[model samples]
Target chain A: MYDALKNITFIIFDLDGVFYRENQSLEGTKEIIDYLNEENIEYCFFTNNSNYKIHRYKEKLLTCGIEVSEKNIFTTTKLIEHYLFENNLDNIYVLGSKQLQDTLYDKYTQNSINPNIVILGMENNITLKDISNTINLIDKDTQIIAANPDKLIPVKDGFELECGVLIDIIEEYTKKMVQVIGKPSPYGFDTILSKFDKQKSETLMIGDTFETDILGAKNANIYAGWINSGNKLPYNTLDFDFMSFKSLIELKEKIKEAKR
Target chain B: MYDALKNITFIIFDLDGVFYRENQSLEGTKEIIDYLNEENIEYCFFTNNSNYKIHRYKEKLLTCGIEVSEKNIFTTTKLIEHYLFENNLDNIYVLGSKQLQDTLYDKYTQNSINPNIVILGMENNITLKDISNTINLIDKDTQIIAANPDKLIPVKDGFELECGVLIDIIEEYTKKMVQVIGKPSPYGFDTILSKFDKQKSETLMIGDTFETDILGAKNANIYAGWINSGNKLPYNTLDFDFMSFKSLIELKEKIKEAKR
Candidate 1:
């Protein structure tokens, strides 16, 4: 374990595909948790899903047999909230669920007349009227914000459209691009780095997706470990220097061998 | 009028921007109707909007001060119905209004499992659940048909998301391209040409947009007269030969000159 992780002082992990999939923890996750605890290495889980708060995620991780502090988890929801607060973007039209809307309730507005921004997030109840109203509000001055850049999220039977898909729809209709504040945007990474005081060279990003995890790590100037679990490869990762493995155990072994 | 339309025995006029805007008739539309009638010219109104049937469009046109037969109108809805009927594609899942759904009610399926085709059309009350269900039904074998390749429809104040926009969202989520059956596709043009036995050289396609009108005309190998009424150019027309005019009056004069 030391041989594999010797060069990395800090690690950024993706929650959905890396640690667990569909609420079930992966096999090598326990070993990695033990190893990380033994090595006293700094790590954090960076998830693009804005569906839940960080505390909820902390509780969820606890149930999955992974003990992590609330501060160790950085969510896109939190990142977006921070951005909105910092930028003084008080008036917002959220096209997401009540839970997601509550994340920025202080700044959210029903004032369509002069909205500061329009935030796109996951909403099972989102309607054409919601989309049309959002379309009408979009102009040169209106800032369109997308929570994440993921096109789809795998479901029980198939895939479900995510925030990025919604953003693309709005962009196509209005011809105005959306500002994604999640993975691959460098904003989330920058926030994590700044908050944790971590150096780019000393940190590594681990996840299963190439577009969000690997591409995001590249954008943030960090090493990436792609957990390719025979899932579909959506994006081209040929240009990046990323290590790919079927399991976290294999990746750990490779890292161990390299350090040795 | 005879000199301009001497060679053109038939004309296909687009309804939305060419003849009317927001339920109001445009200038020179009445004169064109009279001129076409005086010359005993064969003409039809080709519209991409599928909200109303041919008879309803005729009534709407009459109310707008243009008298035309129901047979002299073509819509994307009609084009889709014809395509579905011809191809024997009976099983369908529609993400559109009850009226549009009723157009093919005999074949419409509410079965979430193994649908033959998913037809995307205009729906004001479309929900995310509808989008999700459609996403789940999408596979390699499933045929995704879009009514038109339009991103937005011009509403009273602003624009609303169109069928093509819904198609785009589904395409992005499913990673499967949608087969557009309207406008720039040439399928509609080919059908009209074959059924009506019209010569491409003798027929003119006149509209106010480049994407559908000019592009579709180019694809169908017909002359296009763009009624560019100060709307921002959304597509490139550099590769195609199309007449551009601020008003249909100007286009009429140009067509008259060419015929002379």
Candidate 2:
């Protein structure tokens, strides 16, 4: 059914829940790497997780036995840095991680009493004061820019809240919409396309989650292949048009057959 | 023009900004007290400031030389207490002052990680952690109850952000509507009416701000006389219908002339 895989020039891969869960890589990831190499299909990694830098992601990918260059990786943290740079925003108040904060430390304003922007990212240990300061800053005309809009994220024990939920709550309180710069926002895909010099028609986005990966691809006007990995189709799958496969192994076999 | 004041058997006076600014009482406050006494009209002091309890408000009024009994004082803090008591909500996460928290300490839950309800009120030194906790708590289905929805308050320095602004931000973050208990909410007026057993037509709400006092009166279906005090009418005045007078002294004169 995926005869279009032969025509696909570049592929965009989502990191978490696709290539790896947390500490371990998923089952069919190595197969995908081998198949893509055999087909000479170029691929890049994209993640909305702003907690880690590109080098850390590369190290993690290396441990998973899937070797990739640092330049081939894209994260929301990098996207945010680009966004801030583009908008000429110097003074920023961040509700994010130590890594994300350190990445943009020069632009970080310790005081939220007044700021040019308030960047919202994932913070597992987010406190009430962080939210209060952000609200107050927004009230003072400081804009909010979220790293991504994923509501719930799978943790070791259970699912924890994400940036989208935080953004939802903040937007509800302040009556201000936060600017998002991750998957499903099309910004990440746009960045990837621009960097790789690929056309939307020739590029394909592949991942497990339909909300981010598939929707992001659709939003960017690119083809998407939902890697179900032999799992039941998610509810959002019906709403969007996309090719579905049981596993990356099954997808690769189809790609090989399409080439014949 | 306020012949309605002659028919007003009960009067609700806003304390700060109307009768007084911060430290000193305004010019017309004493005259209103005298007029109410001479006419045998029941009058009470109503304020949204939850910084102090009833006794402190009484003491403050005494210092201003406008002596009134404790029974004649009504505050948003008291209204919130009544609301919590009525709702039987004991497990509360409070964002309020030390005095206000102590006022309802028996009901206040020391932490918000898990609470039946989150109560938002006045906190001059509110932090981001307070807001983050509130947002997280709300995500757990904890209900939100607010003292008042006043966005800005006149302080010794200038207009400072109020509990309403915090509530707005919280509401944005949580997507939960707060149940307000103070001016413009109608809950306070309902409590006042039920306590005094006066019909809306026979009661008058007098104050300087149209957003709170007059709007509350309008919401409660009660008559309202805005005390302009020879000052320019506020922006919200055009949106609401209410009697206007230069001062409470001028309103009193109109009341006397209406009787004659």
Candidate 3:
């Protein structure tokens, strides 16, 4: 698996369509993962989808026949938790799943007296009730932070809800803006870059989303490839360079050939 | 009620904190509504909270001891609907309330062939699935539209969600910004003025939200009032030349006085 990317220290792969499109693995995903695994090359799954907590993805990837451990996974959920924990924020009202609440349990419980911070995540059960609570808290000068600004998520049964929707609800309620922390955001990418041993020039960022993956990598001055697995293309005037690949495997083969 | 205001042909009130502050009624609310009812005056409720459809607010207000007919409502919802309908845009995927959907329903239902426009509101029910559908349709070239872009909603139950959140989510999904329709938007205010017989003068706009209401009135060259609500004492920084009033009874008493 000595690929054209042999010189790179890390390869950040977007989860939804980049690694696996919906249910079926993207063409050549297994081989590439196997190759990366065989070489012991470290890569991070960089996604803006903060709906599910960190560990759920590793198991799902295993089901997709691409083996990976929870330790290897990197989601916005973990990123913001780190941000809050390091900043000494104890109170958090999560606009996301219970898994996220569990992830921040005890340490980041909702503060009744003096709230410290707010974390935005995916909430399957988001109601006007949550919106009310969030708006109230934010109005009370509580700091609001978002795991990711991604408004949509690609799910196995078509696209389900994601964190940004709840973020929208809360943002509108309080008329206050929140900070974003995941992929496409410099926060997650900076984390990957800091952890990565290679320079940005030699690495490749493979993502199916042009906004997050393609543009996000370019924002880091990295080589970005937009895999058009969903067969959708951007129509706006974007000022970034990107490679359009039909699938991840095709790009993999190109990488291998370049190495040879 | 007659102490301050006793002169005016038009009655404009802020939607949220000044009027009813959501499901709960604020102080002096019933007296103000009753005073307006007792007098033959024309008044409109203005809001920047683009959360529910305007009619939903009508329903919400009816339940909250305010006797506001749908005709007395002037919102970004109706403003945007008029814009879309005027441009012959009927088929729409609104990100707002059922009121917004209902507003465009007639125009779209009449066409009943292919939806042409999308009206995004401050939707708490926003889902990633809904975003996906919105993106897919936008990819197919449906014109994107929104009511207003006020980011926060100050509710009586505390602060509520606003419209910018929905715009943020949809922007990530579609990668396309929408045509905004409400206050702080000159176009939205212009649409409202056109609806009424106001010539930017001889008319006054009323609202509690200074960001959208006062600022938007200034942009539209319309007179406005900052609803002090017996709270917000010492009201400062108005975007337009505005009168400050505590209640609608005062407004009616003044309007009658102005006519005399």
Candidate 4:
């Protein structure tokens, strides 16, 4: 099918509710992955959910019937880790799930007071105790950082509560806003672009929503294939032209048609 | 001096270049407003914005300084004008100034296709003749309406062109976005709220900068302030809480003392 998807070298996939919601598969996701693998249509798994480590994300995707290595997945958690490692941060205070805490342990030095930064994620174990430790570090003039500021994440019923709400509540108390590194932010895109040398126009960013996917593409000036499967219109109108598709199978056919 | 200020019963002011920038505003604004004038403050103004005919936004303070108009002096050009007056609004094409034209004139009924809503204001006025005849009722439509985008207001270095630019340019092309009423959109807080028991605490708001003093107030919120003088920051953090005094004089000595 990618035979007609000529010149197209990179395919980006959104994790969580888009490709697979939590532990379940959303139908033909495997077929699309298989097609990409067979066609050498370089693809990367991208997720804004920073609750898990890269391997964990890989494991979750595999459970959903796809396979990828730690290197093949890009999470905002890793992006902040990259920034931290290159800058040599020490004694970080975390605000996230167990998987996120483990990710930092895989990369850095031991914890200490008056360290470098405060990193936040979805802390399933969130407690007043956790908030106290985080705020204490922040009060000591430590830089506060986050995986992203996206307030909500999709759930089966609807959007499950996510990170930004936590960020807002904590920020109001600490009087410090977290530095974010995810979608709509420059950091996440930087991670993607650095991994591939393919032309942007030849690379199609197919995502569900316009505010994040379409707006991000317009800001970066890339070929946008808006997957308007959500049946939504933007509050403010958008400027770039986009092609909407129902499914990956249909998208493959459309690409084949475009190539001809 | 507040002893004298105590006699000043009502106040109304503008919003744009007043409490915020053309788009953004100062930080710590809401924090201050919420702190003071939570009560007893009645009558606030938001005069210079809306280009809309006043209605629905009785509660959308997230964007601008104030959201209350217990007789707010601001106007809504978009809301339907209440009157034993005129109605006939159809076939009116809005060229530009969405803030005003679409928000304000979107609801006028015209006699024919002679362009009822000409919609004009502070804009670059890029294309006029393109739809002027249709709007001005030149060949078809009846009445004309303009959005309150802007003409070109004075700012820092030179003239900051606004909807008027579009109005001027379009007149040559489509003949202006449509001109109904410019400033003092229908719900002028000054005009409507002026006849009341207005106080500072009851109607206080915060904004980042100043463009339009939307209303008169015992309290206003913004980033900039001058005392018949130049822009000045009295201290490092903030001087007063909710009250936005463009001039130290506008704010009473007792208020200043209270702030300290």
Tell me each candidate's RMSD, in Å, in order: 3.6, 4.5, 6.8, 16.5
| Each candidate structure's count of clashing pairs | 4, 24, 20, 129
Task: Please report the candidate that would top DockQ against the real structure.
Answer: 1
* TM-score on alpha carbons, each prediction: 0.86, 0.80, 0.63, 0.47
Over the stretch A18-100, how does candidate 3's per-residue lDDT look in tens digits? Answer: 66665666577788877776666667787776567667788778766777767667888778777886677776667677777
Instruction: Say which candidate scores most in lDDT.
Output: 1
Candidate 2 or 4, higher DockQ? 2
lDDT of 4 at B221: 27
Q: lDDT per prediction?
A: 0.79, 0.79, 0.67, 0.52
Fraction of native contacts (fnat) of each candidate: 0.75, 0.06, 0.38, 0.00
Among these predicted structures, which one has the highest TM-score? 1
Better of 1 and 2 by lDDT: 1
**How would you encode candidate 1's per-residue C-alpha lDDT over A171-253 as one tens digit per residue?**
87678888889998888988898889988988889988888888898998988888887566765656778777788778666
**Residue B10 lDDT, candidate 3, scale 0-100:** 56
Candidate 2 all-Cα RMSD = 4.5
**Which scores greater on TM-score, model 2 or model 4?**
2
Comparing 2 with 3 on lDDT, the higher-scoring candidate is 2
Per-residue alpha-carbon lDDT of model 4 for B1-260, expressed as tens digits? 23333343333334443344445654433543443355233334344444444443344445645555433544534222421024544444544446555453445543334443444344333222222232334433433444343443445533344444344434543432344343323323323433454433333332323222221121232112222223333344233333345532344343435444
- Ranking the candidates on TM-score from highest down gives 1, 2, 3, 4
Candidate 4 residue lDDT tens string, A62-107 = 7878877788788888887887876777778677877777878677
Per-residue C-alpha lDDT of model 3 across residues B1-260, encoded as one tens digit per residue: 23223444455666676767535676666776676667654567766554455677787677658767787786776676578668866556665576666766655653223457677776667554455555555655767777777665555555555666667666766677677777777886666556767665555777776777777777777676767664443355632356666665565556666656
